[model samples]
Target: MKHVLLALDESDDRAVAQAETVRDLFDTEHTTAHLLHDFTDNFEGASVGQIAAVRHAANILEDAGIAVEYHETSGSPSTSIIEAADELDVDAITIAGRERSKAGKVLFGSVSQEVILGTDRPVLVCSRRTEE
Candidate 1:
């Protein structure tokens, strides 16, 4: 079975995009998704299942017949995600990218970018669908 680590933030739209990407790119019947959510200070003590984004993504994947497991950690998002991927030994890591200005990215840094650079495993970056 193929294993994928889906790192989700709080955005429901982004969660949908990530879940859809996983469902589309892998064989749902044989794919197992490890849903991960990093609870920062703002979300301190929150459970992975308590997050809407995680619920949304879980529903999407489960509906697609993909097996799913929930994981939660509190720390740096990028670091936590990378560590989870390593510990889980997933086939790939999927994360949703948010629109940000170059200046913003330079100033605040990007979790997706950090995950892309920090891990040796394949990373799939998904962007939320924009309304036309």
Candidate 2:
């Protein structure tokens, strides 16, 4: 079975778009998606499944016949994502990319960019656009 690590933030649109990318690009019946959410701070013992965006993405993936697993952690998002991918040995990683200026990226540090550079596995970056 194909394994994909879907790293999600708190944005429903972005999470749904990432889920759609996996549904459209892989064989849903034979693929497994591990949904990972990193709470950067103030998690207060919350779980990944409790997040709205994560729940939305999970529903979409499940509806498409994809097997789903939930993972939650507290730390650096990009570091957590890369470590999860390595630990899960996922075939690919799917992440949402937001528009950021060079200065913004340089200052804020793009999680997607760091993840893309950190891992050797294939990465599918979904655009922020949700509309057709």
Question: Per-residue alpha-carbon lDDT of model 1 for 53-118, expressed as tens digits?
Answer: 899999999999999999988889999999999999999999877767976655323787899999
Give residue 56's lDDT in candidate 2 (0 to 100).
98
Cα lDDT tens digits for candidate 2, 39-112: 98853777888899999999999999999999987899999999999999999999887757877655333787
Q: lDDT (CA) for every model shown?
A: 0.90, 0.90
Per-model TM values vs. the true structure: 0.89, 0.89
**Location of the lowest summed lDDT over 10 successive residues in candidate 1:** 102-111
The collision pairs in model 1 are: none
- C-alpha positional error of residue 37 in candidate 1 after TM-score superposition, expressed in Å: 0.4
